[model samples]
Target chain A: MSLCLPYPTLMLVTDRHRSSMSLRDAVRAAVSAGVDLVQLREPDLDDAEIERIARDLIGTIGPRRLVLNGRPGLAARLGLGVHLRDGQRNADVAARGDDRLLGRSIHEAGAVVPDDPPDYVQAGNVFATRTHPDRPGRGLDWLARVVENSPVPVLAIGGIDASNVAGVLRSGCHGIGVIDAILAAADPTVATVTLRQALDRAVRDQQVADTGNHTGILGRGTMI
Target chain B: MTASPWAEDPACLRAALALYLVADPEQSVSGDLVADVAAALAGGVTCVQLRAKRLTDLDAYRLAIELAGLCRQYRVPLLVNDRLDVALAVGADGIHAGVTDLPIEVIQRLGNGRLLIGWSPESDGQISAAAADGAHYLGLGPIFGTATKVDAGEAIGLDGFADRVCHTTLPTVGIGGITSRTAASVVAAGADGVAVVGAILRSSDPRQAAWDLRAVVDAARGVRAG
Candidate 1:
């Protein structure tokens, strides 16, 4: 399947409880530092609070790049994307048509991106993320394997930060999604900028290795 | 309201933009902004802007809910002024941002085109720039001097207001001090409608005031069309 979004991208998986700053500030700062996508994952708050946070976030970064976690109906209503929890095949949300993106979380090695409705899958505990501390990192090798056979681009998550993000990007995953890298940092802008630079560097280096030209890597450059 | 058969008509924008209300809680005669807005709606306000500076966030959200509900029943659109959070939370139709509010270009990029965004630009440059800035409508004015909003810019008057209106094709609404007396002149100045505050709320009879203002604006639109 074709990747519809920008690759070698950075996504912020926002956790309000873990953020050192307000989630809104963190998301805004991260977007300013080139975080291409935001996944609003705060499930504890009520729907009203979630929607307020979503709008505030949208005002900063806009709605096209934001995805609501496990809130398909709300996401659909806002004309934004939705991220499904593990093993949810909610056809109703997926079939709502072409204007929105549908994302999924997967843990198994045998899993495949569903083709009926094009989707990108976020796979991890790639490196022992704080959000899921108990699960050991599945490692970059597993990530490479996932990218190797996966039908759609994969966003690696879990404990992956600027320090370890390059290795994750080298695994051929489309991008990385992190929580503490931006949210819990002393300054989210710096944190996001660091991660963004590292991710861009890694992708640049890989392009050099691939064919000595950035344009040589097929499907790696297109946004749509 | 409905985007159906009228969506094909160019006047659809004018119809929605005409007879607009800039509903402010601080200026409400009865201290009940929701009821004030409902009265204006009954008097044929085509659109409403919930502009609150003194109320708590919850109060504003509650009022937005009531006003949005009223606008829904009346088949007019309700927009929240400068409070994107309140607007989004209450599921209002749009946001009316000022020159200093959240940048409209960012809203256009990230908003996924969900809310009907309205912006006020006081000059020719801003009005021209607004064409590319994802503004669905332009709140252009101080068409006549207004005391309700003390900080409003100097009155653009009829001639200056008309000169700026020609710069953009977006549905235009003249704001800042429009009243039954001056509302028709705003429409005659090329604005699709008129936006007012004290004209509706501070009046002895807000519904009647709105009815008079709506009629005046409609007649001017007819004149301009003819």
Candidate 2:
């Protein structure tokens, strides 16, 4: 089976209003920063608006990977991937005939894997945060369980930062899903580069571990 | 072959489930694997996803064709995962794609209505968006936790699950770590169906396990309806 891994970077699209950073910019930033996938999450946008943004973003992403949150029909219309916050709605949408990449946001171990296994799960609120303050955060321990139990790749979101990105990956997550870290940054590109660097370093470290060399640190050696 | 097992009819989904029987050619999945699926089918599995992960594309294609034939005999639909080429070559009923693979729209365009498409949802927003997008149906879960999906999301509790369901009108099946004991709870939380792998695949008697799980789903749904 093709390996199911998390998007290398996730850019939660929202307007910050300095210069216009539309969905297109979000896509551009993600791509420029080496994001493997980009999801358009304008929950308040109308179908036409979503359609417009999706259309524009698609051109920018150019087959990198674009997910339209909660609008499978539109996603299908645009031939984009669909990410569902709720699995049931996604199932119903699929039943109606939009067969695509259906993903959901899972906050716990038993959140539900759709009958049709999804491409991956975005598990989050890994740390306490300003995003979705109403919900409690799921710590790294809980995140680890999610990583261990899911049938698909789990992308950890909610309060993820460059500092903790390595821990999230080490906890068995396919990758980290960033929100404010990217969207809320002064320079999304810089933030993204830093996070990507950390993630890349983790991968390299993992490789070393896999190669049976665990007695040394990433850059430190015992001098053979 | 036969009509798609995921018929438009909600009753059709509940009447007979599609049972997936996975066997890796490199490693035998155990004869009991078939027995579990058979029992589940007997108990009302209307369809099956024969995912032979270890086989080559050609071999998987042949195996899918064989399994499709068996499903036809049993009047169940068979779906292939991530193998659009094999699915098309085998003429199976549908295809299921993960986020990393082909999008549903591509699947729909390629299938030309002959194949039903299903997606995986990990969050409520994803589910809501997917419902609006017109997916064939969704696989909601890793309900109790499972090792099968190493990167799954946090476990949304039953309350959280119910909350997510409030957003859509689609028929859904719960997946991930589902078992007889937890199946009823998932159904009670408003899942239209329950999909299991190890619960039946790794069982001592897959068939019997399938039946038992089905019974729980049916019973729980009935209670909710009543």
Candidate 3:
């Protein structure tokens, strides 16, 4: 019930990069494709416009997550959650009183862990990402350390995609936060579907390794 | 793979900030408002409190049920402000009480630990008392003066927050006229979390405003020693 899974690899596919589809349309498309979560990061729009789009997307999202990047008020009004961007600062903590999922970015493994932590810590750019250039990639080892030591659930961020999601999971990350993988794609739905499948498989594999459930898979079902 | 939810989850409540969804039955809360909640949920908000000061209990109860459904879908907890019957009727996460409202022990007994009982503490003495009474969390505030609460107390700057929080064992959140601009200082003052009203609900982009505040808290938490 708690999305705070031990090995959750989230794909932080933002609505910023897609030019053809609006955020609402893109969110719908992403939901159809089964992205584990979607964060709305478009800051140019006004609140009313954002609210209109948020309402549109929330209708389709159901139980799936929709994170508002950098807008706690809108989130608060709607009673949704938010994701704090890296290196941003504010004094508003009232928004944290909500029982919605709360998360933030970490430039490094150290930045990811807080003495008073959030729901999850996002450590990023395991690979090169187009969204951010100021940050150098932290690579897989840093991610592993984050996964191992994080006080909260740790998610690998920056430069993550379907092709490398499996590897990142294998490296001990619980989740993946993506950008170009879904946003830049011609078909975000397909990309999301594939990414989710890959992460699921990796989690299953990790679970199998931990529990040795190979026999159960072999006994009850064909090797998927 | 089967890690305990609490174990892997952050030690502090994920959404320590209180997200107030002001309700109105005379004029229905917009779909955009509901979706905003969903979007906020997506953004990782941890709690929602329906402040239906205008609606009748029955109407509020119905709305609470509907909102609770939305919160449930997102796995976020929903609370009702000073409406125990409505909360119980709709099975909300809990109730947030003001000083004049029900006493802490009554709420605790009523909640039976299933609900999180938050008490509004105006001073360090109140915070200490709330802690002693096993209040789930303290809403310490009027961190700044605002129009939100009429006759709101004097603004307790970050320094004052630190002074008050230093005395309480329970998780404390700085509230009252809180905005993204002041979030970092509150967190830096040793508050466990922050709460707001207009910063998001009144913003042009509530999501972004929420994110801005969240970013501040994240930064504030960074100041602590390892």
lDDT of 2 by residue, B52-109 (tens): 6667888787777767765553445577877889988878877766677787777777
True contacts kept of each: 0.00, 0.00, 0.00
Candidate 3 B-chain TM-score: 0.82
Worst 10 residues of 2 chain A by lDDT: A215-224
TM-score for all predictions?
Answer: 0.48, 0.45, 0.49
TM-score order, best first, reads: 3, 1, 2
B1-226: candidate 1 lDDT, tens digit per residue: 3222112233544566777888898898888787787677656577788998778999888888988776654546678899888987877877888898999977644445667788988668899998688788899878777788978878888998888988999878888877788887788788888888999999988877876886687578762110
- Give lDDT tens digits, candidate 3, residues B72-159: 5433457788888898788777778888888878876776646667778766678778867756777777778876666567887677
lDDT of 2 by residue, A38-99 (tens): 66787777999888777777676663367777877777777776777654465555443443
- The TM-score of candidate 3 is 0.49
Instruction: Report DockQ per prediction, comma-separated.
Output: 0.01, 0.01, 0.03
Which candidate, 1 or 2, would have the higher TM-score against the true structure?
1
Q: What ranges in model 2 sit over 4 Å off?
A: A1-224, B1-10, B17-36, B223-226
State the iRMSD of every prediction, in order shown: 27.8, 18.9, 12.6
Of candidates 2 and 1, the better by lDDT: 1
Number of the predicted model whose DockQ against the real structure is largest: 3
The digit string of per-residue lDDT tens for model 1 on A1-224 reads: 32377878688888888887777777888888888889999878887888888888878888878989987778877777888875566575844565677788877644774555346888876643346532324445556767787788788887677666666777788898888878888888888888888888888778778777856533335443
